[model samples]
Target: MSMGSCDINALKLMKKGSVPGMDMAGTVMKCSTGMWKEGDRVCGMLLGGLSSTIVDKKMLDRYGMQGSCATYCRTQCDMICKVPETMPFEEACCMPCCMMMSFQAFNLKTWPYSNKSHEPILVLGAGTSLGLMTCQLGSMMGYKIMAVCEMTEMADVMSFGAEKTFDCNDPQIVEKIMKATQNALTMAMDCSSTDSSLAIAAKCMGSSGGTICCFPLMMMSAGGKTEELMTMDDDSKMETMMEKTMGINMHNIKIVRKLPTTMFGFDAEMMGCMFKPMPDETKHAHAFLKTFSTWMAEGKMKVLPSQMAQNQGMKNLILCMEECKSGGSKMMCKRLVCAMGETGPSV
Candidate 1:
């Protein structure tokens, strides 16, 4: 299992006993459905992925799944995809969450999917797992990727398909992006979803304005003093509040906040504490997952860089999680994987 921002948020907001992981890859031990059989390799994403025990039957009834960090975890057939024989479990685990999130961002109707116009698309936090995936996907789809990442990650970001890269530490980042895009930048994906990142995306938009697709549902308070977690219904209010706080014209700029849980057809609680099934999103996600599975099999996607931890076991999983949460150089631009039980050298 690998840690992601959603897992971090879960640790902060979920109940005390809730599990922490969201992504995992392993061989199937058993299956009730004929869709998959034993010995098949698969990877999946699910809320509360660190526990085998059911903490909430209500949640289980709604999601029909459990955390995947344990030695053995169960998941619905539809929620998982077969891993390519050549792909490592560590790398396959990184896809379900990050790649799918990027897919959802691009799946928007407003996005110019069919037209390979090469329009500039700004990717804030381009160093992040999700941001890197977005850069690759955007570039593969023929968009001009303007990546904003740390100085250390600039090269890797560009290699992922970014046309230009800017240091997030640069005080003149917005100016640089504007100059690079020639003021024609109208689309952006904010993987950071912070006040600063949001403001930067808004300022980089062209005069005709554009849409900013961001992860995490956040709204700025009237005083611009704090961030408030919001629901889907509050998206309009968040857009208005962000514009007011950042002093950007809101009329043309649109803010769309999406949660990865929604991709699985579940609505997360405020701050991502819990989830409830949503019929419409569930159907959409199932269709997407089928296509995603085919893409993985055809080698149409590149997995993010990952390192399998030397000490492999459940206990070491905690240590890996701590290292990821601390955001140190060792874990930057990498996913950490830990094997449970007597997993072989294959893991």
Candidate 2:
């Protein structure tokens, strides 16, 4: 199983003893449907996957947590996709959450292939797994990618398909991006979703404006207001504060907040709020998974760099989780995988 930002969030917010995994790659032990048989190699995503017991959709719906860090896990047949024999289980596990979210972001906008335009797409936090996936996918679709990342990650981000790169630490990052794009940048994906990142993305848009896709729920305060009044739901106040914060006209730029949970057809409860499910999103997600599986089989998709956990079992998994939570240079642009039982190699 591979760790992701969602798993990190689970560590911070979930109740005690709750499992914390969302991506998994392993062989099927049993199946009720003929579509999948015993020993078929597959990988998928679910709410929580780190437990010893089987975690299915029902458990996720009831407890809002299910994980795949266990030696065994159970998910709906439709949730999985076949992993090619050529791909390592560690690499395949990185796709379900991060890659799926990247695909959804591009699908939300017009596809670059359909238009055949080389318009630039800015990716903030390009060093992140999701950001790297977005850059690669956008480039594959023929869009020019402009990325913002740490200096150490610039080369890797470029190799993934970003044509231009800017240092996030640079005080003049917004100006640099604007200058490079001739102040005509139209589209962007903000992986960070922080207040400063959002402001920079808005300011970097062209005079005609464009869309900024944000991966997290936006909560920005104006003055000393309470947190409740800062949600995106409060459009009037949000727009006013955003306009002031970003130093741009809010009417021109469209801010889109998309959560990956919608793809599962379940209301996502986060930070004490419930997000309704969108069936259409689930349909799109299935389609993308099918296409991605094909891509994997054809060796068209490149997997992200991964680090295997030092040991195996739940103790090692907990250590890996803590390392991820602590945050360091070692975790950047890499997925941490923990092998369960004796199935895979021990790092």
Q: Evaluate model 2: give its lDDT.
A: 0.71
Of candidate 1, the 10-residue stretch with the lowest lDDT total is 217-226
Q: Rate the local accuracy (lDDT) of all candidates.
A: 0.70, 0.71
User: What is candidate 2's lDDT per residue for 55-160, written digit by digit as tens?
Assistant: 2446464433357767777666776788999998878888777777787676453222343768888999898887888898888878889999989999889988
Q: Which candidate has the highest TM-score of all?
A: 2
For candidate 1, write residues 1-347 as lDDT tens digits.
77655565556445555556777888887777688887888888766632322334575665556565677776677878888898877778887877767877775543224446778899998997778888988887788899999998988888789989999989998889899999888889987777778888989998888888877522311113225524434667777776676677777888876666655554455532343445655665666677677878898887887776665778787776776667554453667776665641111
lDDT of 1 at 81: 82
Clashing residue pairs for model 1: 49-67, 49-68
Clash totals for all models, in order?
2, 8
Question: Residue 273 error for model 1, in Å?
Answer: 11
Q: Cα deviation of 171 in candidate 2 (Å)?
A: 3.3
What lDDT, from 0 to 1, does candidate 1 have? 0.70
Residues forming the 10-long window of minimal summed lDDT in candidate 2: 217-226
Q: What's the TM-score of every candidate structure?
A: 0.84, 0.85
Candidate 2 regions off by >4 Å? 49-65, 107-115, 217-237, 245-248, 344-347
